[model samples]
Target: MCGIVTAISTDNVVPVLLEGLRKLEYRGYDSAGLAVLHEDSLVRVRSAGRVAELATMAASRHLTGNIGIAHTRWATHGEPSERNAHPHVSAGLAVVHNGIIENYEAIRERLTAKGFVFESETDTETIAHLVRDKLNAGQPLLEAVRLTANELEGAYAIGVISEADPFTAVVARKGSPLLLGVGERGIYAASDTSALLQVTRKVVYLEDGDVAELKLTGYRIFRPDGSPVERTVTVSSLSADAVELGQYRHYMQKEIFEQPQALGNTLEMIAGGNTISPQVFGAHAGDVLGATRRVLIIACGTSFHAGLVARYWLESIAGIPCAVEIASEYRYRVSVADPETLVVVISQSGETADTLAALKHAKQLGMDKTLAICNVPESAIVRETALRFITRAGPEIGVASTKAFTTQLAALALLTLALAKINDRLTADDENTYLTALRHLPVAVTKVLELEPEIEQWAQRFASKQHALFLGRGRHWPIAMEGALKLKEISYIHAESYAAGELKHGPLALVDRDMPVIAVAPADELLEKLKSNLQEVRARGGELYVFADAGSEIPESDGVHILHMPEHYGMLSPVLHVIPLQLLSYHAALVKGTDVDKPRNLAKSVTVE
Candidate 1:
């Protein structure tokens, strides 16, 4: 995935483009570049590092223009270098692009034979040349871009600046995210809202296969049929201050602490009721849930773990057959999908590439019932789904998710209750119990945050360990997986999770005195069986680090350590149990002196495969 922005203004657009690139750098920061139309030429400058380097380079070279395109890349087709950087200019056309062009190789060969000289090894470069070639054949700038788009075969959001059109930059999206920001001073297009938050709050989200031309004072959008289209300019509620890391050392920690408020915002709709209303999902939620015969949850990364936990809740509480799959794998494999199945896609950013692909794949299989539980309002997943629940976990800047995961679980719990009501499986008493638990959830998570000091001490112990094994049973198993993922992601430790029952199934051999075994010991029905499985590790001399509920009786002895939860939250225990794991990973990564926010080789949003 890469970040792109196109802007034209009466004021010099260089500073706006540079600031936009800085904000979008979290998408990818391997390289950064921008191309601006100055007088009669496209002046391009690129650097092979963070956006700061690009800014320094441009400053030294005095690169200036009023109309421009910018990009911060996460390399997919080529290495991250100055030559491979974006703003690939050719034949008077300067282009910055996000997403992959799958048909690049074949198109490249055809164009090479046509005597078009190539410079860098990039799928994006091919797009630049294709537009350049079309323009060289006397096509107007907009027509050349339309011709170039018709020749492409893959997901992409492109920004094009032509020397011929000094005041206009064209942008397009197909299976990738793009949006336009309208301002009194100028018009802007970007891969995400963060890039335009400072410039304007009014935005128009572009649909797939849509193209637009941003001009100095206005913009126009066109459908795939070349007909002009109008889009609503929703005033985005996001503020510039929400994205800043105030006192927190890292974005992950800030997000972790934001769980209570984020979750409260997510639960606000259902807070006053005794039972969940399907209206919380969408206006047609009740009709969709009432007809759903089964559910298929698709997601990637931490969102996948949230879906796994939802599987247990849906099957156990709602009496629905639920299955969870990694979106990347699910997209490649053949599967039995029915029209009655509710295909649920979970994502924090709503722009996850593989998850969006899987959502489309399910639709291709004739599954009409779709729901997206996501954080961002105008994300691709939410836009494509028939029904959607927007989680209010605003602006998760950390590469590793914290508040978003907890809020997903909260939304999924509401889904469970709503589905149960639809199936007549929920009793009045049980509904009241769940509603009360949800109302108290924010307070519960607040208390869980209090355990950080104790958990950090445990984290100090884990800093020296090279490997870790995590265990849980039943619904809590997914919590174990999330715990391991957090540890490995930020701490740079080798960690793996196994169902407690599966310890005997070959994974038990990895247990040793030097390796710590972390267990999610909630006082559920599986506690006794999970304890028996833990004995296997204890017998193998594996040091134990158990996050047990207040009453869970998982003892602390010589080699066994027990960090007691303040209370037992029953089905909601996963939300509480995970907080400590997050704290442990955060503190352990701190001790290890690793990059906690931008972990190695990972982007905040995986918008590319």
Candidate 2:
């Protein structure tokens, strides 16, 4: 997962490309590079590490060009080094690529037999050599891009600039994201809308098998067969302020602290308590309740975990039968759908590849009652679905999502309440209690944030541990899974989560004195069973770290540690319990010297399959 940005203009384009890359750095930041078509040669500058290093190198040398393309890479095919940094150039063409090329070895063999030599270890470099070979054979630049796309066999969003066509840039996509920005001065293209937010709000999202030839004067959209197509440009509603990390040490920290306000805004919109009512779902509640026979929640990564939590809410509180599936797995399964089945897709960016494909598949199966819970209002998920629920988390730049995950939970909780009301499953008192608890969540979350100092101290004790086990029961099982995910994602620690009762079946063997276990043991009926599970871990010599509610008497042990939490209602406890685990992971990663914002082999958005 890499970020790509290209600018074609009448004036020098280096500055615009750099600014765009800054906004898109969250996508990938292992290494950075840029290729500019200057006069009759391709000028390239690259460096390892953050975009700031690349900016310094570019400024030291006057890299002036009217057309240029840039990339910030996350290492996939090779190690993070200057040799593997993108803006991979060949004889006459320079290209920046986003997704993986699965057939690169096959193509490389064919090209090597033709006496073509590769200078870099990236799969993207193969495209540049292939385009150069096509151009040498008298094919036009646009035709060369099309032929390359035909030969390629995986996910990719590529931008190519050639000395033969110094005035134009070609772009094509298969499974990854690509967007075209229409500005008054020139045309800009990038992997996501965040890169183009500063220059223009109007954008056209490129579809699979579509290509665009961008020139200084104008741009044309074409199919893979070179047929002209009329593309609809939608105005982006994302504010310029959304991309900035105002007065914060890092975007990750800012996003973690923004949860209170984000949750409050989402609740206010959904419940119509302090702000304008959200028309996203309330307007369609009656129709959704009347027409739907079952509900399906599709997502991946952190969003999938949120869906897991929502499954409980929808089934238990709303009396609705619900199915939660990972999007990639759900897309290939045999499915039957009708007007009676409602598909709900959860995504932060709303551009996740598998989830988007599943949404399209459901629509193809003739399911018209489809809805999206997303943060980006103008994303493909929102544009394709008939109904949309927008999360109020403004912009989550962290690779490991914090605010967005909580807001999704808050939004889904409200959705469950609405469904229960329309379906006559919930009585007036039940609805009032749930709503009141939700309204108090912002304050509860604030109380959780205050536990950071204690969490940091706990993290110091287990920062050197190589593995951890997380346990929860019932509704808290999803919380356990999410806690393990956050720990592994950022800290690079091997962590596993299990239903507390299932530990004895298999996972108990992994327990030892060296292993540390974190259990989400809130004061509920399940607390007694969870205590027995903790004792089992202790009997096996595994260190125990329990997050318990205040006034709960957890048995003391020499190796066990406890962090008492502020008491809250049962359903809302997960919302508070998740906070300390997040901080624990954050501090552990900080101590381990791992990149908390951009973890290895991970991207903020999974636009490619």
Candidate 3:
């Protein structure tokens, strides 16, 4: 969850490093710092706060150089403090790292025994010591980093610079994301493309275990074995304005409003089409879908909730058996391997560490038929999968996902239709009907976004509450889970979700005047049963907030509050039902005066376990 930006330039790079760190704020960092080679001497500045604070510190200290490395760290091994900040230096070698070094303790002991002192309690410090140790052995900058990387045993994206080698900075990635930025002024390295979009649109996304050495004029890539390699440089499609807040107060709010467009973009290929084609997924999707007898969906967080919804769609619509697994637990537990199962891995960033590991685990189990539904193109998960669907959610900057989740649902829906067609479960009329619904889905979400003003009123009430219980039935049960997640993520509220029928089991006890019970009351077949569950909540003296379909006839009563959706979208209703919940969370966080974009203890991309 940390960020790294390294540059070797012909001019002062403090501004570039600082601005790059600011761009990576969405990745969620508690500490910021930079180390530069000024006059062939290592000069470092750090702050246990925002990039702005680091910028101020750098300015006050007149920190300027032609070559440098910067970091925005989300604490892992150490607490958020100046002493624990990155740009960990040893023997004139500076290193900033993004992922965990699993064997840091043993390495730390070895280094300590060898009389190498550590000033910071970070796994990153071990890398600096190791690299500096290689330098002490008379290795060059690139060789030193490559030798140190060989000793590392966990995921990491690291940037290293040495005062003795002022002309170069070496960056490497193994099980984490790292890229090289090419520009006229300098050569750069960043953990994310967004960080270097300002410096250069052309970037070489380094493969796992690839290392790069950056100089003012050019860069060179090497494999883990120190063999030379070449990576393709591609232009990024993301604009600087794509990440801007624009007129919105926060990125979360902006992303919430962007859902309709995101969904439209994700499903754009199906427009004006009467049939749902398997080719929409990939070139071999037809063969894969035709052969898939069972589906196993793997993901984490919001993507996991999306998978839960997909399970219902895959089974009920396609008449195929489906199961959803939390990626972290799936890999650790032993399970029966089914060769007929189509393993679907979903992630917004596509770099989720657990999900990727789980995919590898499934592969190890001989489940070779793999698919990835993700937002970022060319992500590790996408590359690992045999089939892929790239959601055009653009860039989701908020730590709490909005557009990405909805876009994933859109992609999953397409997959469902494709599979249903492949199995002959979907007739021509059925395909047309679902296609029309899919085309109209954006408009439906736009209408839901219009309910934000009304939802804000509900959020104002929610902000004062310490707990919430969300209830939904059938396919919408997962929507309830997602709503509760959004509330817990941004609003600092403890929220729980249950399938409406499960309320009587134990969650009903949590229902009271102080605990808000939010219900997703769509006009599906389970409407009456969900209403019965709501009645139970009302009987318990619980405050109720309901988002219902317009024609559901769930009237506003003394203790019940209702916001009717503009339409009932049948199987696609979960996609619409989630919009108001996102707004509710965003507004609740806003009313609570919390950080709406970067929630505490959360990062946009979970690159580490």
Candidate 4:
């Protein structure tokens, strides 16, 4: 995962480049760099830290140019350092690349035989040298870039700039995301639309094997075989203010609090209706769901956790057999495919590499009933699937996801209700009951937000803990896993989650006063079983912090702490129970002085393998 922004403009673009980098820092912040063609020379600058550091260095060097390319890297091939940063330069050509160059070693050997030397340990440097070699062999700038791209293998999105051709920039995409922004004064290219929203909303999403040339006033697109192609320019629907951290101390905190609004926006379609129709997913959703016999869900990271929760709802409510698989592992393994199974892929960005590949693999195995639940409508996964549900969570700028996860759960609940109705498993009264709960979900989440001050108090004690164990039963088991993930992601604490029934098998061995035990104790069928698991922890002298339903009669004792939720929320209890855990991780990170928005060794979107 990385970010790339390049532009050819009539005026100095240093400010635009830096601002774009700042907006894209969530994609990566390991290192940042830029290269500009100015006064018949290529000028490059780089830093080993955040984009703000690069901005400071650019100001000190007084770097200015009308045509430039900038990058914030995620450090795939080499360690994070100034030498391994992007905008790798060679001769008069400079290149900024995203994704891996799989055959770089052989290409590097061939270039070395030709007496070409490399300066960085990144796969991107080979691209600059190859393009420079092509230009030296009498190929024009555009042809040199296209020829160099043909010689390369593996997924990549690249932007090139040359001193010899100072007014134009060349770009190409194979797998990783890249787009062109048609602006009033310039033509721009970036990995994400968020980077160019300030200047222009008109964007052209590039297809695989497509190359483009950008100039001050116009642009051209070409296929890999040199045939000119046409691509539609779409106006982006995202507002620029959505990415800004307004009044909040960190993007993570803002996203965490935005859950109520996000859920309301996502569930707006079923507001006044007494039942959820299958058509809410898409026009063809009725046909697909009616024929589906089983379900298969594929995802990674936070999306994977959402799918795990859906498995519980799908089997229990819809009376359907469902399987949730980790995308990275599922794609490589040889598994039997059932055509009657509906393949559901969930992603926030819709461009996750492993999940997209897994969807393609399922298609190759003759599973054609594909559906995508995602936030971005134009993302590759949504485009490839037959049916889709677009979540209205807006832009999630934090590396650790908050609003996106909650909105996904809300969407999955709708899907469960729709499938249950189609299978005749849901009664009229049952439909009305579930729909009423969905309508009041936003208000329920608002009530949960009021518990933040209490959660922060718990975080003050949690910050000193080095290890933690989280326990839950039934459907809330995945929520416990998510809570553990958030704690380690931002606060850097060691955390583990287990189903309450599995505690006696193994994880109970690590319990002691030094390790805190957190439990999600909802007032449900498994409440008594979960309470017994808590006693096992108390017997081991483990400190206890439990988020229980208001009706639960659990009281705070010497080593036991209890924070009551506003209500039980019935089937939606998992969604309400997760909010306090999110606040706990956020405040703990705040107390520990860790970067909450951009956590270490993590990116907001996983676009690369």
Candidate 1, residue 357: the lDDT equals 90
Each prediction's total of clashing residue pairs, residues at least 3 apart in sequence or on different chains, is 0, 0, 0, 0
In candidate 2, the residue pairs with backbone N, CA or C atoms under 3 Å apart (3 or more residues apart, or in different chains) clash, namely none
- TM-score winner between 2 and 4, please give it: 4
lDDT to native, each model:
0.90, 0.86, 0.92, 0.92
TM-score of each: 0.97, 0.90, 0.99, 0.99
Deviating ranges (above 4 Å) for candidate 4: none
**Model 3 lDDT per residue over 57-136, tens place:** 99899888999999999999889999999899998889999999999999999999999998988999999999988899
lDDT of 1 by residue, 1-609 (tens): 578988888888889999999888666468899989887687898989888888998889888878899998888878889999998988788999888898999999999999988899999889998998888889988878877898899888999988788877899998778899998889999988989997899999998888898887688888877889998889999999998889999888999999999999999987787777898889999999999989999999899999999999999999999999999999999798789899999998888989999998999999989999999988889988999999999998888899999999999999999999899999999999999998899999999899899888998887999999999998999999999999999999999999999999999999899999999999999999999998999899999999999889877999999988889999888999999999999999999999898787788888788
Q: Which ranges in model 2 have alpha carbons more than 4 Å from their true place? A: 78-81, 101-123, 133-140, 143-153, 225-241, 271-279, 282-285, 332-339, 361-368, 555-558
Candidate 1 or 4, higher lDDT? Answer: 4
User: Model 1: which ten-residue window has the lowest total lDDT?
Assistant: 22-31
Model 2 TM-score on a 0 to 1 scale: 0.90
Flag regions of model 1 displaced more than 4 Å: none
Q: Ten residues in a row with the worst lDDT in model 4? A: 20-29
359-475: candidate 4 lDDT, tens digit per residue: 999999999999999999888899899999999999999888888999999999999999999999999999999989988988999999999999999999979999999998999
